[model samples]
Target: MAKALIKYALTALLLCTGLAGAQAQESGSSAARKAVPKIQDGWLDVRAGEGQGRLPIHVSRDWSQAQPAVRRALIVVHGITRDDLLAGERAAAKVPSAADDAIIITPQFLIAEDVAAHQLPELTLRWGVDDWKAGFKAQAPAPLSAYAVMDAIFARLLDRQLFPNLQSIVLAGHSAGGQYLQRYALFGQGSALVDQAGVRLRYVVANPSSYAYANDLRPLAAGGFAAADASQCERVDRWPYSLSANLPAYARKPLDPAALMRRYLAHDVIYLLGEEDKDPHHPQLDKSCAGEAQGDSRLQRGRYYFAYAAQFPRDAAFKQRLFIVPGVAHNSTRMFGSSCGLAALFDEGRCTTEVAAP
Candidate 1:
């Protein structure tokens, strides 16, 4: 009987020990997920207020030097993960032709936490993680809007001496990055610089959680859309969701909704939507009342925005198009690496253009 009791005690102790170990491992993983990401090495110096600020970036070529052979430039923005290096590498790989004649650049927009974690220099520009994606003002180095950093990057690319033969520029992003590009498409002033430089500019937006509607319209459940009821969702038309209010300093200018709509519809923008990105419960999916007002999922929101924009009065040269890529989800790799992605980014493959059903 004593031996039996000893054996039972041993078994209980063993079980407790195992449970403790498992809990410890889970705790470690949770800490790791919350840990700050490492900062990138390469930097681009730009004007921040009266002084200069530095931004991290990964470039396929030495953009500082003249690359006469370069005819196209692709700028791939990282999503919420801010994995700029990997994003740049994957983007360059998607276009094999980029090896010889095109340059790929990926810019990293770090947040305050990243700087504090890495003991970064004071001149390093940092923003609120979410605000940066929305073109909001950076928190450090200066109150410069994140979009201004983009403007500086565009100015650098337009240097006639560096890329003498540069004929086109493509700005591509996925997920949160897509949100950035979408809002930028509506309010960003970089296109004017690219236009003045006589370089054709295009935007590739994929799988953004939500879109910035030009007006107050929101998707309805049964079919079509109706202007959002302000009493039900007061913040529905706010900036980054729509052009109604709280526009970032970089994007805030005197303009009416109708004029903004005209500018947006005239721009050449392509959307890449994963057919399988319909999970309404995806953790990263925006489920706020404002977000829900758009649609239930990324796929639905994208289609609704595309169709909504189409209803606006556009010029004969309306340039926005949507491509729904089959068998992809909220993944940047699959969304940007698919045939539709390839065609949209590099004009290399075929993409089935999607039109809103009548």
Candidate 2:
């Protein structure tokens, strides 16, 4: 009988140990949700995904307290520089008067070396090359795509507990950041998740180098749009340009021109262009054959794209506008902070096509 008791005691102890370890792992996973530095004014505690996880989005110090008072979530994405923390800070400071209780978030997509160089905390996700820009899988140890990061963020924000009363979610980006949103708006699989969240969603694309066209039609140099000379540039309708073929992995499915067009038109989108950003041969300007197929200059392309979408007959409910911010060049700071920027964001600032050039 003593021998039997000893064996039973040993078995109980092993079971307890196993349970304790499982509980600890569960706690650790929960604790790993976010890591916030001691600093203020940026970097929130909203985190998702796994393995070398991405940075927690930046936010105002009072974000928690402000959640209850918030009505809008202004998600400002960074450009090719991947300096979203800084971008978020600057963009948040430019809030329109109408967005009295809006919350601003900036998702920081980093490079592997950037963390070590800047001494950032460990487990900070970083993409190799420009993979993140295309919503490609993140660097090894974490297979999360850039688009998935945004998806997780939207889900978290829509949580009844985190933000109980959000009325609008604005996904806005400039330059490379603009390119990300433009594609995500068309191909992000999370659109259904966002749509069901019962909040109004907005997409503001500011001064992107190019756009994803629904058809193979390319804008002409002399006048209207037309099909590209297939023999000359057969790859004209490729990914990131015209949804022709070879879509990136993050592209949820094959680009269905008609479906994409309907989805894009149904969403609330605004193309905010910088009027003075008209340098046809600007060094940073996309000189790629695809870009040239759009227009000669950023200003021209924005105007042309807007016209194209406006003329699309499939979706009669297409309600998109292209607003040119006066006197602003290729600067997001001035572009977003201008009175015109305020209007695009909060629906209450002065913006008109007719303005004296700055």
Candidate 3:
């Protein structure tokens, strides 16, 4: 009986040891899978206020082989419901792999399934009509705003001490991403963090759903309106409209066209619109915002904003440019890859086109 008991005990000990080995192996594998190359690609935690979350950042640079001063860094922001990894892959594929001096950083956002689930206060506050915070009190969590996430990413880049030879930083975004950057530029003015960075910030806004306010509508001269007639002056309201209602009562009441121009002039702002995106029935169209005051279509909205900017005091110095690319529609990869689309943002000579109100 003693011999049999000893045999059973030995077998049980061996079984336990085998299970322990398997668990250790599995844990090691998981760590290996998450461990990306620290040189070009890796994940870093971005501090959003006090909370922290991992933001995956992909970096590409080859300054060791190229002229130091020629090095340029670009941060690519993706649209809603889209992943930055996919966007970065598409962008990197289109550009020649031989371009060594440019460093592209595509940072991913913490967006989940529900759209309204993560509604940012900084954004909703712009549209005063809806108190989304109060209405969805239970759903509201201390989440990061689009701008906050951007700020965190920039801070992390500086902390990483990477891209030592970087000279310029371009903030490029498409569709909803463009919308976020537009507001970010306006809100970030004179902030100590951005001002001290010594980084030349330029914006490439591609086919955003909405745009900042230009100014109060002005009636075109009779000759100018002849083509469209009195209907041209008729007010139309549209979806994804400006946050006019949210403007503080004590704030600058009148919409100043010159001020708008001055804000845009501070940065290199370029708008790349898809010619095929003129469709009013496009699936992504924000019909409600477009239909409000001067409401017609996305094409018309773009024209109006462009014309209004032209009326600025420094209109000549701050000459605005817009690109209407053929055979593209509301897709960042398509817009950025097209000859006219990406060229419009990079090339000053080829990108410049007169903004004439239609």
Candidate 4:
């Protein structure tokens, strides 16, 4: 009876310890979630038709006056954390050239909890936790697409009075931000604004979870492309995955596939893939059927997408380059701070342009 009692008491103590540890972990996570900032440093006025809203952004310099020395602009987008300030600053610091030659702007997309936590004004735009990453319409104030915020910023940048010497614009993002830019590059009207202003535009997509396919074709495990089995996942060809009719209001009408493909190919896009980011079961990696249809890992998805784009007939202006960053994972700072990242931004460093043989 004494031995039985001792065993039972020891088991009870172990269970109690486990339960306490779980509760402590849960409490710590809740505290960390609550610690995220409610807003950014500056406000960007975005007005589309009758819908007017304010976006929180971090501008490296005061745009009110003319920045004649500014020859390049770097618009860096943050990942899921919405920490734009740190992202923008870190990217700018990676450039080894003249510091004042470029202006950096980073925009933050807030959520309902953020507005509620800080009691922000109603006109301050907000979206669902991860919806903004896909150009979803904002929840409060006016129904505005998050891409429209980028449009407004682009329009402001086109002003010669503010940035008279601005020659090129490097729109870059990492992870979720890369996903946003990859989709926005196809549908967003901001690129047209840059073209009209006669400013060179470049997009640097780094380590996104997935890519937007122009067709039903997906990468095969062995080596080639094949149409996805719709019987397995019905929504394989949906928006944000492939070009479909079910697009956000920002995209407006359904685009012609051929034209869209041609336009995207003609645009200069630099893809950066991390060599060490090959974990198939990464917690933050997109595990949906659509994502898996692309590849098993971020690195594979990037390689597959680059090869897929090569199959298309690009115009004379085609300028797409892909670089594999050695010894890096799904880290924003390390990926963007590498030689390839600096070359993609400042056109100075020597980045490896070709992938190694398997």
- In model 4, the Cα lDDT at residue 295 comes to 75
Q: Give lDDT tens digits, candidate 1, residues 150-190.
A: 78888989999998999999999888788888888786878
A best-first ranking of the candidates according to their lDDT comes to 4, 1, 2, 3
lDDT by residue for model 3 over 1-358, one digit each (tens)? Answer: 5445443333322322323322321112232223222212445443444344444456564323444543455677665443434554455455563155566677644322222343323222111111111111111233333455566656644432454555566677776567656656554432236447766566777776556553433223221110111122221111123333343221235645446447665666666777766765554443431232222345554554556555545544664566776777777878776766545433323544334433
lDDT of 2 at 79: 66
Going through the candidates in the order shown, the clash numbers are: 0, 3, 16, 0
> lDDT for each of the candidates?
0.76, 0.66, 0.46, 0.77
Candidates' RMSD to native: 12.9, 19.4, 21.7, 10.9
TM-score of 3: 0.62
C-alpha-based local distance difference test score of model 3: 0.46
Poorest stretch of ten by lDDT in candidate 1? 20-29
Q: How much RMSD separates candidate 4 from the native structure?
A: 10.9
Error of 4 at 25 (Å): 24
lDDT of 4 by residue, 1-358 (tens): 5455443333322322323222321112233234246477799998986498888888888997889989988888877666534655675676656486988888988877778887888888988655687888999788889899889989888899999999999889888889889888987888998998899999999999888888887766556666665445544677778885467878857578667877888788999899999997776676666666677789999999988888776666446888889999988888877888888877866796555322
Residue 40 Cα positional deviation in candidate 4, in Å, after optimal superposition: 1.6
Best by lDDT: 4
TM-score of each: 0.87, 0.79, 0.62, 0.87
Q: Which stretches of candidate 1 lie over 4 Å from their true place?
A: 1-36, 48-51, 353-358
lDDT of 1 at 317: 63
Better of 2 and 4 by lDDT: 4
Candidate 4 pairs with clashing backbones? none
